[model samples]
Target: MITYNPKDWFTFIFRFHKADTLRQLAPLIIGISVYCWIVAFLELNVFRLSENSHVKNITAMHTLLSFVISMLLVFRTNTAYDRWWEGRKLWGSLVNNSRNLAIKLNAILGHEEAAHRSFFKKIIPMYASVLSHHLHAETTRLALDEHEHPELKNLDTNRHMPNQVASMMFQRVNRLYEEGKIKGDQLIVLNSELQSFTDIMGACERIKNTPIPFSYSVFLKKFIFFYVMTLPFSFVISLGYIAIPVVAFIFYVLASLELIAEEIEDPFGGDENDLPMIKMASNIKKHVAEILN
Candidate 1:
């Protein structure tokens, strides 16, 4: 995601180039211009329908339609933002819970033996980092070269990648129990932490798999196109030549907003506004290192 500080609005807007924005908006601009020309030709010559009374009625209808469209846009944007924010919040909880689990594990197992303490310290962060890597694979590949873990290199499985990593962690936890480093109760507590990781993973998966319905998206696109096509005819008599660019700009803003909502709706993807899973993993490494040392 674009990490904009509160004071960086000027810089943010100046350099704001999302390639998807151009891809979505280009066709919209072309369609609107072509539509305006067609409407202008018909209104001026063939129909001669650019009278004041006709314009007034069309303007009233456009106003009502614009209000309804604005409401739809607002609802769509709000829903997308909620999904984005919730994903971030869930990850935030994962970070906190991981740290808490590490601390608890240390308290329970640290006193048993220095070797066990070191092992738990090393493994907790590794587990969190692996989880982060798994979550981001759909969006971007994990930079294994930069954050190389010998343990991760050895992992090979045909099953789901994240689940495999979780299984590895569980096996390690079981080993700790079998070694008599942790009591039965401590094992139960560790299992709870692992369960939290599983829950977060499931939540992210749900968001990734479930999308806004295809019908709603199709309807929204069609409505926007039809609305822009009809706009110039409504304004040709009143605004004359000025109606062209005016209608184009209005369509541009509405289309851009819709494009942004779509991009952020699945914030786990490789979009400009997607969650920074790599950065989060790095932070997890740092925090884990601090605790270990």
Candidate 2:
């Protein structure tokens, strides 16, 4: 994310760093430029290859190829964006469902019962916060510290972390029913709320595990690089020195779009562009505390 906006033409041309500035492309760019210069020199002084009828025909074919490559890049970018957007939407649903579960828990637990109400209200949000942290592989330090109840401190278990946290909440709800702290109907309502939370967890896990096919990614990357390398030759005869910068700009734009799509394709990663899992977990903590108070 380069954030600065260039207002003037000078800044616009010079300020934007080429996106394919990756170290892997350095040797490729240098080699291609040298190759192109040699080709141009031969055409101009040595062999006069550009004047050959066959060379003219090959250049025309490359022009059509460039158009096809451009279309492929566009389609690849769109596909990546779809995956990124879908992951974001899933997280958005997780937030809403978590909040709904908390509100329902508070209502069913009976806010008038001081101890049971306070415990259930506080624990419901703790479940969300803990689950969020668990999803991101964070330790539940803050979540554990927030609850005053002794039973919550012992809620820790050895199961899959997020599932373990959810189970803790389920156990607490079961205890409330067994101890007569909540009625049978109230237990049923709380169970439904807990089930919704489980559904959210499952959805997030599915998105995190599934990804775009490896073959498609490999094919697209190969095509983009090949297209970029071949681009300058198509323009060298007509555009001469101008071809270098023009080809670079076009390659940079295509590479940048591809890189961005890669970054967002897995929204759960620790990348800056990834969904802020830590922040969401913290927010769940804050919201739960407010409801308890």
TM-score of each: 0.85, 0.78
Q: Write the per-residue lDDT of candidate 2 for residues 18-107, one digit (tens) a residue.
A: 442454356655665666676567555676545443554556666777788778768777877776677667656666766766676666
Clashing pairs in 2: none
Q: How would you encode candidate 1's per-residue C-alpha lDDT over 179-266 as one tens digit per residue?
A: 8877898899889988888898899877877888889888898888788877887787777667888888888888888888998888
For model 2, the run of ten residues with the poorest summed lDDT:
16-25
RMSD (CA, Å), candidate 1 to true, equals 3.5
The per-prediction CA RMSD against the true structure, in angstroms, equals 3.5, 4.2
Local distance difference test, each candidate: 0.74, 0.66
Model 1 misplaced regions, further than 4 Å = 7-15, 19-23, 45-47, 53-56, 111-123, 137-154
Best by TM-score: 1
